[model samples]
Target: MASLPQALPEPRAAGPAERPAPPPVARVRRRRRPSGEPPPLPRQLRASGRWWLGLSALVLLACVAVVATGTIRYVDVADTRVLQAIAEIRSPALTAVAEVLGLLASDPVLHAIWLVDLVLLAVFRRWRHLMVWLGVGLLVINVGAAMATTLQRPRPFEVEVLGEWSGFAMPSLPVTVLAALLVSTLYSLVPPGRKRTVGKWVVCGLLVLTAASRLYLAQDHPTGVLAGVVLGVATPLAAFRLLTPNSVHPVRYTRARPAHLDVSGDRGAAIVRALRDQLGLVVTDVSPFGLAGSGGSTPLKITVKADDTVRADESCVFGKLYAATHVRSDRWYKLGRTLLYGRLEDEKPFQSVRRLVQYEDYILRLFSDGGLRVPQPLGIVEITPEREYLLVTEFIAGAREAGEAEIDDAVIDQGLGIVRRMWEIGMAHRDIKPANLLVRDGTLYLIDSAFAEVRPSPWRQAVDLANMMLVLALRTDAERVYRRARLHFSDEEIAEAFAATRGLTMPSQLRRMLRQQGRDLQDQFLALLPFRLPPVRIQRWTWRRAGLTVVALAAAAIAAYVSAGVLAAPL
Candidate 1:
């Protein structure tokens, strides 16, 4: 809302020696932009990974065909020469050192390193990276072994084999396993950028030491080690870059919540650009807002620069970022609720990020048009196509949560009035918690309409009323709130509200707050009514739920078996 004053040209003396003064330098304020280019989308990473995979496959196949056909006589001669040269310089000390290096590349040592990496990934709760690591290991081991057996290549000829030997020789298994393990560890454990760049050189040095040791001991043909390194490095590198990309799942040791994304770097710049291009609003600043009370999406406070195209009074807007991760979280949440209580008033997951943001924007417009005290919708901004979006709304300045605001007769009436209006419009704010309700200047406003539904079930509407009453009572006594609520609804309706609502119906935030009050607020409200009704049954068994349960159990069993093998397998 404020700007720096521009510098003006200084007065010059009127003299023959004084030439035309140069124009005054403009004072430029450099905004802190992210240092590097914006991160590639998930689709871009996957595409590049597939390219690497295809190239590796083609190279490996060509090497196999050349060796199997024996069409290249010069290649065999070259391999023999390298082994003879190593034998010529062999000494007791060199042999001892070579034996130790060979041991380092053995199955037992390599498997031990692999198990340690698995444990670390599990401890960090990097489940996606863990899966990719295990998959790459299993793929290289099983597929490499099969290929080696089919080729049936023996150890180097005309050289004394000084190291341990295994089935076949071409495409050595130890080299492949080592390459995969080291690459996976670097990507999964080490954060990208400078540290990862330094790690690449370190890994390359170790890989070279292992490959050279194998050649010196005459354990396998030189060509075998080349193929092993290529296959080993490409598979896991591609998998990690494609699956657990640094842009999405960063490897950091911090106590920050996972649901809240870091908006200080490329994402911050993207948000500013998206607002300017998509919504014609110049965002001057973007930062986290009310993260403690939000868990579904990143809450951001956006500062818009005032200009001719935009209203001078329009300085800030509230935005919530919805990404692919949030979409998955929404799916998991709906799936869990559906399994717990079958078809609890259309618990269906959104198909993508676009739909999720669109739904909230539509609901906000719908409510504002219906003359409800809600934030005015400002349309949605596209950040990265359907992968990410920002839902913009008017920032209610100088407002506090209903729980923090002073509760009075007017506040009580306003709280009840919102629920009454929703009922009239055949809609329901399924999440009616203290955090979702804001009050300012003797007026109450509702936020977070992501869960609001049109033509909601009567049971849902009743739950909404009950939750609103509970939230209002947290700041005041239940008896006073109920007496005020009775003026707008009949006693029978109040009884049905209590009957339809239960512990599961209330949002988690509201439930925890009620627990801390150290009293049964729900029971207190129900006692004020004349008669009670039977509790409504929310849980209903359905075929889809039964199938989901069976599928979940099967997946768990498979994961358990794999985990046991990874941890307890014999070296």
Candidate 2:
């Protein structure tokens, strides 16, 4: 009567395969020009980023309304008769190399290389590239020196004026403050793709060679070097829409991630075509498991095979590839620790990536249909679009970690029948710790039930029995794991699972179990688990959070009238 191993299906990633290839060798040795309609430059460069931030904020409010309008005095006497006919057709070999390229792009040698790049971005603390060069060099050098001292406008050629400068030009603060500090220091020291497009055309060719050496040394006139390179490219595009990062994160306060490396090469062959197009598992090979952590989603590890349609005892499996394109800054790190504590994680409540690979393939087919032990998932892949996914399972062949085995009593009676069949089918794993428990051959599998759940939670089943009884009392102890967790919890449900670690939600797996079980196992788990804090009413909703209690009683009545106007301001 043998008939079970089926469970694969899931699907959904569907994008790259409506079959379209064979076009390149210069589009078939260049001939068919009679329009076939395939390449509208990738649909007119899929524009979005707020249409290039509203076309660089309408060309920086039309170059700060043409340098405070005298609208370049209708081409100021035709740009002072084309800079006195190019400063009388200069030729002492091009006016001594335009007076040494206007004293090597001067303004005190680019303000001593912008004060040694703001003292090495304050000795490398980078505060967002020193707040985009102190908010785009204090609004492009004090609004182009108060719009060149209230449009005083004067300079052009009192003699063969070759170098030295003065002021009152209306705009030319070194071609709008060195093209907005060399395009925000080549967009904060060249980063985004192709070395920030060759550092934006080498800061627009050294801001057009310092605006053609301030108009070949005739100095301020070509409408003040075209209104100081249009207020230095609109003050670093309005300091990138006012210091962007409202949310980026991908977790980078460093450390952790070293479980060997390669952190996914060739995105592990696009996660073996997302396990043969979303979990059918046709992959042949790909490996490297565990240690992905540091965020910006890069979990990988494979060892597939599957092929000959499944059964060689459901062919070799072992894979983990989450790839949410390497989840940066802890993708809203567990919804900001469940919006600052309370109602913790249970996977999907949506934070997309196909709702975390459809909530870890519905928590490994709800722990392989209730009989507990896990892994088995074997499929679900979306290798990109709403940013990547992959979740093949079945990798248990002789497992290991519950902190490298040996807590004894047959791994404490198969982690007490996987925590009493997850509290008799009213589930809740809420990450049980000891690297998601394993111990293979001698049973107890439960590997990452991607924050398992089912409902009727008693403080998430007392955080999966006080994180598997303080991860088996750190590999043995606390009275032999509280005498095998009092044969399934008693002393007041182990003091409400050690008083639900005083309202946990300090997430990263309860801050790595209070930095490896400290606070002397919280008074030896508050003298053997099970707590009591029943109290009563605190319903201050006032019609469902009346505008957050009138903005917290108008910020505590303006902080008690500014602390009684600083104690009636007399001192």
Best by TM-score: 1
TM-score of 1: 0.84
TM-score of every candidate: 0.84, 0.31
lDDT of 2 at 429: 74
The TM-score that candidate 2 achieves is 0.31
Residue-level lDDT of model 2, residues 1-571, one tens digit each, is 2222232221111111132222111101212213463321111222333554465466446556766674866667787788887778778898777767666456666666566666665665444555666567666777777767866777864446677777676677766766776766665554455776777787777777767876877877876777677667765755653452211111122354411223334455656654554444555567555563223333444544544554553355665545332342234455444333323332233456667677778877766666676766655655544545556666665577776676677667567557766787778777676667877656667777665677745866876776776676676766677666666556666666666554352236545655765646545766654445342122323432455446667976985575344223211
Clashing pairs in 1: none
Which residue window of length 10 is worst by lDDT in model 2?
Answer: 21-30
**Among these predicted structures, which one has the highest lDDT?**
1
